[model samples]
Target: MNRWPLWAVLTPGEPARLERRVRAALMLEGDEEHGKGPSFEVIPGRGRYHAIVGADSSDVGAEFQIAKDLSREVDEPVYAIDRGNDPWAVTSWRKGVLEVLEVDPESLAESLGCLLPGRELPSDSSSKRPLRKVALVEGIRAQEASRALEDAGDPFPPGHYRFEDTPQGLRVSSETGDVGFADITLSERLPDVMAYGVIASPNLDMFFVNVLRGGECIGHFALPPRDDSFVPAVRDIKGENSPERILAALGIPAEWFRNE
Candidate 1:
């Protein structure tokens, strides 16, 4: 999996300052809040520090969002290392203009490898995969959805969905149109459909399951943190009759939700 590298220049002896800036930029306060920020390491000879963030399995736009947010917070230039080329290119914004610098692959990998033990740099052969297509259907039973998805060679199991990386944003395509992540409206209001099913990303980390009945979204569940023991919660929620019962089964405190 590819990881985007974000780095900034550090003064000769200001490691503590760099740490503080990183914490602030990434909002890494606590485990429940930030989990773990990025993996940080100081370059062996260069005196500069780098933080690697955003997994390839995650949305590519998320990495760019981090870079953009950090760019506004720091005085020093923020570099985004692009690994698609044979020799990776480093991009930065200077004086409101973008600059690209190419570096040798072997040397760069050697330096990064030393800092990131057990991690391997992306290979030159790696290429962007094609956009995945999926069909969304209403009035389908779980068994029928599984059968149809299996016939179409979908990787995800029944009753699960995930957003896909797109140039526009995180999207999930349906027969009607594309639904962007920002456009997802979680409302108690129901639609007129009987049952709804969506084929989406196979990665559970990004997985979510939404159940709609009578044309209304009754349950919307995303994968919880590892410590939350999500599987049992999902099973319990599935057994519940109403949306309130499902929410109660989740064990999380209730909150007021607005209709979108």
Candidate 2:
């Protein structure tokens, strides 16, 4: 039998009360004028509201899109929950980004119990999976990186480059940097030091200033693009003076950026 996937539209904030309300709303009072709308349930321990719209075997992509649309219309988060797969699954879309992840089925089932009281929970098979250093959920790491950067005092100027916290990682973009051509240089005097142009676009340009540490080429700070048509304010800034500020902004100790 083709396993049918479950769907829900979730609203943010305290979920427990919402779950109770959803349950109450779905219940019929002595078979009279109750149970008016769709039924919802709380995923145990998870902090989000859920409305259970059971099993649709239609196109998964379309289902996901519908969920996204609902999220936008209701101004709240929405999700597609499926237990057909090995690890179980939950998906959501936000800010033109789609996020999907395999989650613990037992935990998900426990949460679904309020709506699916007698249903069987899927078995757990993730014991052998290795732990990941970074979480798969979108924007978590980038937010951390951004906070680190901000606490360090916004070292990089806002004019030429923009640093974004993304699901993949920290994305650095240059507004006026050239993408086609890059300059890479190494210095014997500095030993194991290398600088390479990293990103360039119509509005941005940047370079990776890396220093070797423990046999690894660790990038310290990205240098802003330089052009001859510079204003006096920009011209006065020097490359040599950037490390402390950049490291500070990144919330890393100054000694960490130095060659050991």
Candidate 3:
């Protein structure tokens, strides 16, 4: 038998309470209301989760909604697992928070590292497989690298993205606006560096301004502060984490950061 491509994973305070909310989220009086074998189900997950299963888990469907809704209701962390898709990702929601992650080593390690601060992932592949499996999901990209954001609409839809180079800095543009990778970000990817970081969000709601070297902050202040970065800001105004503020701080031309 085939496995459900996607399901919600939760470690809840009360399973019975959660199930009731799940039923309500599915908008059914009972399981059979959907006219399928059963409209909804929550089973013991393979690991430390109660996997909430339903007919369809796509964002357009009811399956994933239960995961996010219940997390907020119970003040818990709920994850939506999608095994049937590419660049597999774990959709997580807590309170009103959300993040979509792809199932790769470096990035997945970052996600786990945050969850288990100061802990390191063993080098063995077997031990690392679970994190990879659960975090597996499609990556966020804006538009084909070939296209540009021609409109000024809000809530830009996620699609293919393009990375452009300009005199000011690197540009990660989507269908709606250009996400600025300020000069500091440009410095991170300088001609020679052992490794670096890139932080972004699908809708450009998040961005970071930091230049890490030898595992020291030496420069910026970012939110939810990363474990390995001790960077401090120069006592500037708030919102420096934003593209516009970041660009303003650089004293560079703004044409590259703003939507053309």
Best model number under lDDT = 3
In terms of TM-score, the best-performing candidate is 3
Candidate 1, superposed: residue stretches over 4 Å from native? 1-13, 32-45, 48-77, 82-90, 95-260
Model 3, position 6, has a per-residue lDDT of: 33
Per-residue lDDT tens digits for candidate 3, residues 140-185, read 1223222222221212244433444433333444333322211112
Candidate 2, which segments miss by more than 4 Å at Cα?
1-48, 59-62, 74-76, 105-260
lDDT of 1 by residue, 112-158 (tens): 33242232443422222211222233333334434433453343334
Q: Candidate 2, residue 106: CA error in Å?
A: 6.0
Candidate 2 lDDT, 103-151, residue by residue in tens:
5434544464423333343242221121111111122343443443344
Ranking by TM-score: 3, 1, 2
lDDT of each: 0.34, 0.33, 0.36
TM-scores of the candidates are: 0.32, 0.27, 0.36
Q: Local error of candidate 3 at 83, Å?
A: 3.7
- Model 3 bad stretches (over 4 Å): 1-3, 30-36, 45-48, 57-64, 102-260
Model 1 TM-score, all chains together = 0.32
Q: Could you arrange the candidates by lDDT from highest to lowest?
A: 3, 1, 2
